[model samples]
Target: MNPGGLDYNYEDWTTIMNMTAKTSVLNLTQEEFIYPGNRACSGCGLSILYRIGLKALGRDCIFVVPPSCLTVMQGLFPIAATQMPVLNCTFASTAAIATGVRAAMKRLGRDTQVVAWAGDGGTSDIGIQALSGALERVEDIIYICYDNEAYMNTGVQRSGTTPQGTLTTTTPLSGKAEASKNIPAIIAAHNPAYLATCSASYPLDFHDKLLKAKEIKGLKYLHIQTPCPPGWGCEERMTVEIGRTAVETGLFDLYEIEDGQMKLSGPSQKLLGKTSLRPVREYLEMQVRFKALSDEQINVMQAEIDQKWAGYRDTF
Candidate 1:
């Protein structure tokens, strides 16, 4: 049996290994699952990630979304942006709902994938209990948390995943005092079948990871760093650029862990042995949220990034 309590199949493992080859942008499917004219903001990073993600998941999937920006983006009632079926749940029950949906699918002899999509607040704060329970039970589902730093869905409040020194509405003057939660590390402890970190800037990378996760049984968790324009105080068009800068500066990484082994994805892989990464200040300067950050604070953040990469070098 796999770590997730599912019956292990050697052939399935081989197939998954063979499919790890990177997908090229040119070869991506032309099919679009999300229709045009949605409520998503201009240059919303989640929109980009969602569009590419659906292509990778295909039509044989059901989505469990909570009260988030995504719920607003998909429209209301009679109109919807996505072609697939979505069940909107409360802020704290995303994983529980997904588990129920997966159980129903199995009872009906259907192979449809169940996905739980939520923002950082919903995942790291409000919904973590359900997520942890699902992971521990080895529920068959894909749980995706798109971290935009703060709670953008409801007036930009501070969330558990919000980084230190970010100027969210709740942390107005002094910025956030506590460090951001390391959610992936927490999820890793549950020993899920698969886990990954993705960036909204790299759609194909996220797509490939989802495709890989789809073939695996039991729980798979993917945490993606998605940039928000109004919340982050950046121009709308710079969302993708800001997201890419996060990876280049070591603020965020792209990687996957399967069967207890971790591997860096392409963008971050190329950065492994580099002498230095782009300054974290460059990433900070791009966002208005960090406007009040002092030079000392920036230096401290840079040191933390350097120290992190040093550890990565030792491990990878």
Candidate 2:
């Protein structure tokens, strides 16, 4: 029972949460912001992420893209796949460019959000400096890193966000010497107005996040795990299921931090410590990239997740 709040048992809680989520989905208009007929892969997770993100953002915004899969998805100059205005920037200047756009719009009194959408390679690796500078200045823009983990557009090379024990062109069987860079933790230290990790597995959660960020001013960093079909060596149609397992397995916990307060949400909220948690093996066995991992390597991966869980638990 929900003492003093509402008399409800476990079943009632489940029904209420489901209804709340369903309401969120129905709340979004049926208007299609992201146009079809792009060069996106068969089941590209980022493409799905873009579609959902735009639905939450509506058409009253601009998209800033760098040399990533998104740029490819948006298509060549004059002709584009996306419906809204898109500005292409250099590999390491997406955030810097977005900052300028937001500044210009503010000066001109334009009521619109400037979204800097980039990939893991651009955000966590090369573009990190520019992004940090923008956030330090508290740039009034929304920066989202659609993390596919590796540089899939450039032949599946290992990126800064690529996890350990995963086979990439650069990291092969031995896998990365070090663990994936703790990007979310690093950015969380900056303490933006809003910071969250998301996955395409849950559309309603992803949409709600973007919608909430749109209302907040200043830097809003969203790191979304968009599992690459070919890069991660998973079936194209299995992306959503993999995304779900990724969270349940503690590989990609969904949580949001606002002004130094960190709160777990979505699947991760229930999985914290003992309420609910799934084994990492199920998440690992499905991906070819991880299929070649040795017992020791898998153990290392488990250790990493354990540590991450402990840290988040401590935050409470």
Backbone clashes, candidate 1: 0
Model 2, 1-316: lDDT tens digits are 2344454443453354435544254344455767789999988999888887887776779899999989998887678789988989999999999988998999999978999999999999999999999989999899999999999999899999998777899998777776789898888878898998999887768887887788898899999999889999988999999999999888788999998898998778887657436778889998999876888877877787888888877775
TM-score (all chains, Cα) for each model: 0.93, 0.90
The regions of model 2 sitting more than 4 angstroms off are 1-23, 273-276, 310-315
Q: With candidate 2 superimposed using the best TM-score fit, by how many Å does residue 184's alpha carbon deviate from the native?
A: 1.3
Q: Candidate 1: TM-score?
A: 0.93
- Model 2 is weakest, by summed lDDT over 10 consecutive residues, at 1-10
Clashing pairs in 2: none
Task: For candidate 1, list the clashing residue pairs, or say none.
Answer: none
- The candidate 1 region of ten consecutive residues with least summed lDDT is 1-10
TM-score of 2: 0.90
Q: Positional deviation of 165 in candidate 2, in angstroms?
A: 1.7
Of the candidates shown, which would achieve the greatest lDDT relative to the real structure?
Answer: 1
lDDT of 1 by residue, 160-179 (tens): 99999999999999899999
In terms of TM-score, which candidate is strongest?
1
